[model samples]
Target: MKYQVMHDSGPRLRVRAGQWAFTKEEGYGLASLLLDQDFIHDVFTSYRNGSILIYYDGEVENKQRIFDILDGITIDDLFEAEPTQTQVSKEITDDFYWNISGMIGRRLLGKWFLPMPIRNAITLYRAIKYIWNGLDSLTSFRVDVALLDGAAVTGALLQGQYDPASSMMFLLSISDELEHYTVQKAKSTLKDSLALNIDTVWLVDDDGEEKQVPAMDIDKGDRIKVRMGDVVPVDGKVVDGEGMVNEASMTGEPLAVHKTNGKTVHAGTVMEEGNIVVEVYSMNKETRLNKIIDLIENSEDLKAETQGKAERLADSIVPYSFLATALTYLITRNASKALSVLMVDFSCAIKLTTPLSVISAMREASDNRMMVKGGKFLEHYANADTIVFDKTGTLTNATPKVVDVIPMSRRYKRDEILRMAACIEEHFAHSIATSIVNQAAEEGLKHDEDHSEVEYIVAHGIVTEYDGKRAVIGSRHFLFDDEKIKLTKTQEKKIEKEATEHSVVYLAIDGKLEGLICIDDPVREEAKYVIEELKSLGIENVIMLTGDGESGAKAGAKSLGITQYRSQVLPEDKSRIVEELKAEGKTVIMVGDGINDSPALAAADVSVSMKHSSDIAREVADISLLSDDLYDLVTLRKLSVGMLDKINTNYRNILVFNGSLLVLGVMGLIQPATSSMLHNLSTMIFGAMSTKSVLSDRDISNDIEVEAIQVADAS
Candidate 1:
């Protein structure tokens, strides 16, 4: 099909043939023909040499090569060499000489010189640049890289508008990984997350009633409430609520978590709380719980962690290629060996393997409900030595239910106190409010739509009158600072226990502390397996970082066997911690599900976030797990390590394969056909290797590094 040149910058032209985009080979080929027929023809005719040679002649390849030989020499120098008396009469060189000489005058000396030869030269130059640029992107220090955008890749395949050689290399490489056994295993992650039924949504009713469903709408450090019938919104420690929760979705355990104000809970767990308010601290995906799920599911990442040696080697190859060619000729005094060195120095295997491993690992991770956005992070994940975890979302669930309600004043009945708090909290959509309202409902109290005029306070407390007695429910700090309410000893103890065991909600009636409610967020059962797997994968240190109170954080950490812990840590602290680890020469991989974790994730060697991760976290994370299962972490590490191994092997093979050709060429043992076949075969082999990234090993065996996640129910 005829394709037109759609774009041109000097000699670099982009032509679209049907749906394909062409750059070097096909593009250069077409441009060369145009240059010769139009521009070269004009110059030849202008020079009065058009009748001497034909432009479409099949002998152009040899003609161009000969032109290169006499590149700087004038027409007279060619004939100056003395010819034997017998050479002119019957020799092949003699016959070829005049024909070439005349052709040079007609084609080489005119516009054809720049249009045909120079065009092909520039195309070759562009091809080499594209390859080098791709390699640069894989290094620690980012280099300018151009992508064969979807438009480019698709266009080339459909319209045949691309350089056939370059396109074939990339697409064929993709095909190779697809055919490999291990690469196929990684490819299965995409479907698993979608199949797990972990998606969370908000229950907004037309009647103005809204319920919070776990797995969605998770803001970092925001309180979320789960009712007796609903799912937990995110991963968090129980802080001021008591409830029974079913966590089979995450932990594969049937036992319920009797979570009360200090335990962690996972998303997708069913709530069995009697009554409680669960403060939300990490609904990172904006939907409340999807962020945690997204983190656990993405077992793959695109970050590459090539050592200094690999990087230096990648950078040195180009110069080394020229050096090898020069030294071969110097040592052997043979053009064949030097040519072999130069021609076989493409660096395909070394360049392709690193990215291929990342790609395959990412796919494998997704099979276990992990989604990785790129191959770059997958490389980095394998190198992580220290993993900083967020306690609330990382180790605990976000489903806090109302467990206990204590009345300080004898004038108020326990049920009346609960109903008043629930009535006033109806306007708020927070987790605490849900616990109160649901608690009131379970007692079969018919809610009164008529509410006495109540004032909505900001971050302090709510104020209103109940049963003609002034009543309010708010945090201790808010009441003391905003409303001038002092706490009694008994109330202080209640608040202390709430803060220590779990998150708490403070209730005050008529300007004094009334009582406290404790909530719990239990550890996810899958977390244990995930941790064990990571340890098995060779990660010796597991640290928990949380903004929650120390006792609450430690309580949950101990239940899960994590001794290294940091509580009450802010977002800035998280970032600083990662930097400190990196400074200590530790390769840190951070797994988090909140916006607060974005900076830390960006700062770490590699960061893997959940699909429900906050926008900022997702933006910075190298791998995105669309599913909410920690088991995916194990698959990611395994696939990544395995993939890298394959890549290294391929790199060594390329060196040996190409190096052997130079030796054979020097000994005069290799023919043109044999050398050409090897060269072509290497390209196919490299492509096939890249395809292996997709066709990963299907075994979810003992080899992979799975995160030790402990899924538990807080009931």
Candidate 2:
């Protein structure tokens, strides 16, 4: 291979592969090879300039290793490489316009350039296929849009109006082409959104040294090192080190889970903090991400009620169209008048534009980092009157910070208390634990594992041994009631004063109260504004449900201007509340990001999971917000409402326009040919309009934050 370095910077390099890179095939091949390199983070190839850009995170000393690898590679290597799914999808989508243009050119040549007899014969042949489809519908006892189109063409041919009959068939062909194009474009956008591009990982060798290797080369029992912000490339168990691994991509829970020796991790999840060495249990098999892509590809069953109704209504109108044609013939004793009545049926435009509008809105929502599962959920979200939010991760920021540390034990200083807390806290993966450990690190408090084996009690706390004595850290109830740790009157009073308006984690040693860590969880910056926008958008009830104490929940609700909130609510109680609201005939939307909120997410009329939500919560949710911004919720609502409005507008416009065409044809003011042409032309026009974005510039700019607005525009 021959190349020249065009640009070089830390961790990034651009080079000209050769003159052959001017071809797309050569560029893609080079990109595919570079992307497979273990040290490379990303590869961008430009066929126009015969150049390739590579990003890597390896050591600076290993920079020359990249050039050495490329030196041994040749264009022949690219020919043997398998094409990625993303590349194939792009190729297919790009070819759509070429196919459409060819079809239109062939149709025009047949109609205007071919001899009259040959053109008429070809028109008759195409008309028979449509007529057969109509006959099949009739035999199946279904009246549909196909029947209406067949009747129009048949009437024109019987009256010896070859031009109108050929024109009608040609227009129907164009309508079919437009529908196919819309569907393919939507699928391509969705496929691109869900793709996972992890190709390499750092493998741990027998000597305990980490070496960069292609993910495909790793197998069972191999150890790999996953660092913060790196997507796990294989399903494995922790062998050494510890970290907070975010399994939201697999579990739908927004918070990262703690991974230590012997803990299991899955592929596609990211390490949010620290680093871990994992022993691979599985590699290169079906991943959770692939399942999500499958779900998106096979989401036809999730269509909205309006879409189904439009389809049914289109079928139902066919009989009425037949009767109208018969009535027109009886009144005028004219075939042309009867043909005119058949030419302007409303089924085509109504059925075609309805789903197009819904899909286009879904694509627009995806642009804003909101992945809606189906059109029905979008409709449900738009109509939801009441919204129930999980207070911990939904309304407040998921990241909590230590506000105060109250040391009660005379044997230990405050710094000693924090050092012991961080040692144990680092063993767990919760917001409280993260806050404690982070605070200790910021203060430069370091400690060896002075504790013995740590055991975690779900929803209670953690227990271990310090200096052969029992140690515990958890909630007030977990310490006082479960562990029976007694608190002195002075200590109780101190806790009441310091932890009254914040979340508190208790620490006890040898069955005696030692210290308390107070945590403050600030509300998200956009929470208040998004809440107000939801109300303005017609949400009638906004409520918060939390497992936090009354004071904490009340403060959060008040700060966000929410009037209704239920504190000390358990997980099941949250679902019960959602169900109770639904029992009252309220359409409820539940927003949450933890395992506790999974049941409620499933119980709601529509549910949204934040980007960091637990896997179970995400699986139960109808929509997933890809960013930690409440403004996306507002954007989603506006997009859903806009979709409904667009559908309604299409219906009204079709009715008025098509109805006028029918009347004019019946009065002999317009010929049957002109009526048919106008009818299909209008359907195509509305279909094209349906693909336009539902969100206006003003709506996006005014409601969404500047950074988010820019992301949407870039997408």
Candidate 3:
């Protein structure tokens, strides 16, 4: 791959490879390939001009690396490459522009060069499809905008108004094309948003040494390692080792499937237990995970409650349109007036604008690094009055730190207890376990593999054998009640006094309390501000639900200014509470990021999961925040509310403007042709407006900060 640098300034680099350097597919491939580089932020490729524009991290080493990568590329690389989001979007946009241009060009050519008879014949031929659609709707005992449109065009043809009939058909064709383009473009954008982005993977070399490498660098037959709690990065067969792979993301099953050697596993699935070295067969665009994403993209039309209502209302209004047309003809004895009334039916604008607004709003959400699965979820989020938050990853820092470790037993020192805990906990992927392991590392303690096979009890504690003795570590209930690990009154009082505000992990050795580890999961910096914003946005109840101790839960709630909280709550209890809230007629939005949160997430009207969440949690969530920012919650709320407002505004404007056109035509103030033109023109205008961004161009964080300052000053 030979290329010349055409221009370079700071982080922007532009180069030309020469005319016809690659095909369109190759261009898309190149763009996706380039985008995978760590140094490159964005890339654009044009096959026609053989040009590439790369926006990259400005570093001298990075610049040299970019050139080195470009020089090593071969045609074989382009053949195996897959298109990026930008490429998909570019293709859709190009298709739309070409389609519109072709439609207009043909229409103009016919009017200028074709005979009047040919034009009328062409108009009549196009009118058949619309008439058939109208007749089909009527046969099915339904009246809709199609019937109205058909009637309007048919009436013009019958009255020998060939030019008006042609114009109506032309406008109708434009509407259809616009609707198709809007939907396709929206789906493309959403597919990009919902993509399962895996940045890096652990690659196993020939000698069996494992090293972290960029996911893109893995090729066919390259072995990659997947451990418990990590998402599998490629679609491959397990060549060595075994694990319980959670295929919930693909199959929607809650259970994890066991996979050993020779069994194939998919990307996007989570390894629940054990470890496996996978021989990669496919990745990126070719993986089975992409198939699931395609299915999700097809579900983009899961209409919002408001959107559904608007569509139903649009269809219901068709009978009234026919009724008005009939009344106009009978009263004025004028076919022109009746036809005008038919031309301006409300259903077209209503149906088109509502969906456009929804899809556009979803695109905006994706742009802001939030993946809203469907329009209905956004609606649910907006109308929700009550919100339930899972404290650990939602309200607090995702990476919790171990603040203290107390050894109750004189047989072991504090460091010894920490080392033993880290050795066992290192086998799991939970945040608390990570904290314990990190603490051991910070204290310069090496916790070797010292325990027997460890068993993880979800939402409880881990159990294993250490030195031929039963070792347990988990929640208070898991240890005291479940395991019958008795704690002396003095030790219990000591724990209460020392770890009151911090979440505590209890450790027991052979049914006796041995130590206590305090985990400091601090509240997010913007959490309180997000809660305040939610309240200002009309949320009535803000509640925290956690499995942490009562004292810890209370402390978290107090810090976030939340008045209500339920501590020591089980997963099932969380779901029950959400159900109870719904029973009270409160729309609930649940935010969580763990396996335990899955049930409650499903029970809520809308559920949001944060980035770096468990794979199962991400799969179950209605919306996923790609950025680790609680403030995205506030952005989501504002966007949803704005969507509803936009829909209403479009509805009102469509009705008023079209209604006026109808009245004017009926009162002999305008010709039927003028009315037809204005009606279609207004529908297109409103539709284009619907695709506009609901949220302002200003950054959400900056706006929130400004508003917060203003509020403080006002007080």
Candidate 4:
């Protein structure tokens, strides 16, 4: 682990351990290890130079900790090396540079050293492949870019112009290489942003007691518990228990795999049913399940609809280009002029630039803390006219506050009821549960483990065993209608009078009403402004749906300037409403953050999940905002719209510029070689332009800063 300081700045440091200090895999391992530190923001490591450059928090203690961690690295750490997404991107980039250099070297050396006959033979051999591809397209009854390219090269060869023919083929080869490199680089960039953040897991002790602990605290050989609806936190083998685990994240198959004792389970897969205790095999950088290239490959199938249309249009224009070439040859009786006309068709630029635009936009979205699954979702979001929002977590601030606690039964005190609720609720992700836990903490109430085997009923409530009683806490529907818990007239009246406007959580123990907790969810300060901005951006209908009472929903809608809303809606009702909106010919966008929101998410044209969304909701959503700010939604809208605009602009420019080229070529103002070279150069230029970001930093920030200042002043 001996190393020397190469460079040092306030927040950036470079250290080297000499050549061959670690292999390429170990460099990835070192980078992953450094990145896991809370103080480190980014890291770059090179095995050849044996250098690690670290970007980190500027605090004094953080700097010291980085050095200490580096000093402590052991040879054993290298054995557990695994490649990170950053490493994958670096590998692809290196390969691209090397391959491009090698291609150029071969082209130049072949030209300078090889005699005329050998060079001609090589050009003719390459021309045969292009000609065969054109024949294949003809056999399929489709004239495409391949046929046009083939015709251009064949004309040059027939005219005994081997140098021009070879040059054209070389340029085409370079274009194909560039396209492949762009696609692979885009996938690598996207894969880095899709990593799952598992903060905590249930660790099982040697005595078989299960306790929740941070995921980072566990290492190889630790046993952990995985339950229904929970994501497996590490790659491991099941020591005991059984479950149906969903391997969709690892394998694209939709079905869950049945895993029992001695069977293998992977990190990032979710347990759909049953429970299992897993013996940890690998953690962090060594986990095999992190290789998710298949998922990235699958995203190619989710191309934007506009991109598909552009590709089809490019092909459809190919036949017309052939007709133009034939007409020119018949009228002028000049083979060279006809060949020049054929060289300037409009497919290459159209096909290359559209996808590059989408991929670049996606990368920009990722840089702004948003994970977009595919380009089609961006197109859908851009075209969406109506948007539906869930009440608690979407419109209002998700941090609800506990206002009051009323005891229904004389046996339990208010503090006792509050403590009990927090004890069971701490494990759940609902806003109400967080409010109760925060309230208990503020009141200095310590809620230790007093419950056993808590069961979560999605959208309804929680059921658990508390103090030798069946304790149930949730919505009124869950306690009264579903569980058949009776509420006396007097108690009902007391609750109605006390919790008139606030949302109430009913708590029942041993089939008796024990207490009621009142929660008040305040509206987000920026909600009204975001709504106004969305309207300005062409979002016509803004609607809110909630499970709260009508009065609460009405007030929330009024405060947010939303004219349409639905109250007391169940999960199924939310889905039905979205479907009804679609039936009305509106492209709908649904925003939600709970397991109950999954159905509505699937029903909408495009769905977005908040930063703190549940696992199921994130799984169903097309886009997930990693930042907590609601304004990121506005940013997403602008990005999607900007992407569409760029695509259209590219299309228009391609048609006009290529058309001018065609006219000049047919007029005999340019040679066939010049026409071919100019056409390929334009395609490369358009592609390079498409990769530029759609929205500049100033474009995204200026409006946000102004609106935020205005909102603050008004408040």
TM-score: which candidate is best? 3
For each candidate in the order shown, give its overall lDDT on alpha carbons.
0.55, 0.81, 0.86, 0.85
Write candidate 4's Cα lDDT for 612-672 as tens digits: 8867567667898888778888888999999999999999999999898889888999988
Please provide TM-scores, in order, for all candidate models, with all chains considered together: 0.53, 0.80, 0.86, 0.84
Off by over 4 Å in 3: 1-22, 29-81, 105-132, 135-142, 199-225, 233-245, 251-267, 276-292, 295-301, 426-429, 438-450, 697-699, 702-715
Which runs of model 1 end up more than 4 angstroms from their true locations?
A: 1-315, 363-368, 424-436, 446-485, 494-500, 509-511, 568-585, 594-605, 611-622, 693-715
Q: State the local distance difference test value for candidate 1.
A: 0.55
Residue lDDT tens for model 2, 1-715: 7789999888888888665544676667667777766788766665655677788985676578888877887656655333466555555655666777887899878767899899888888888988898888778877778777777888888888888888788778878877776666666655554455566889899999988987778888899998755677777899899988767557655456889999998876777566899998876535556666667676776688889899998888888989988999999998888888888879999989998998889879887789887789999999999999898888888899999888897988898889999999897767879999999999999989999978765456889999888999987767888899998899978877778898788899998988888888898877887889899999999999976667777788898999999987766688889999999999999999876676688778899999998655655678989888778888889999999999999999999999999899889899888998999889989998988998887776754564564466559
Candidate numbers, best TM-score first, in rank order: 3, 4, 2, 1
Cα error, residue 694 of model 2, in Å, equals 1.7
TM-score, candidate number 3: 0.86
Off by over 4 Å in 4: 1-81, 98-132, 135-142, 162-167, 193-223, 227-229, 234-275, 278-300, 407-429, 444-453, 464-470, 488-494, 509-514, 710-712
Q: Model 1, range 352-371, lDDT digits (tens) per residue?
A: 55545555556556555666
Backbone clashes, candidate 2:
12
The clash numbers for all candidates, in the given order, read: 150, 12, 0, 0
Error of 3 at 204 (Å): 7.2
Residue 672 alpha-carbon offset, candidate 2, angstroms: 1.5
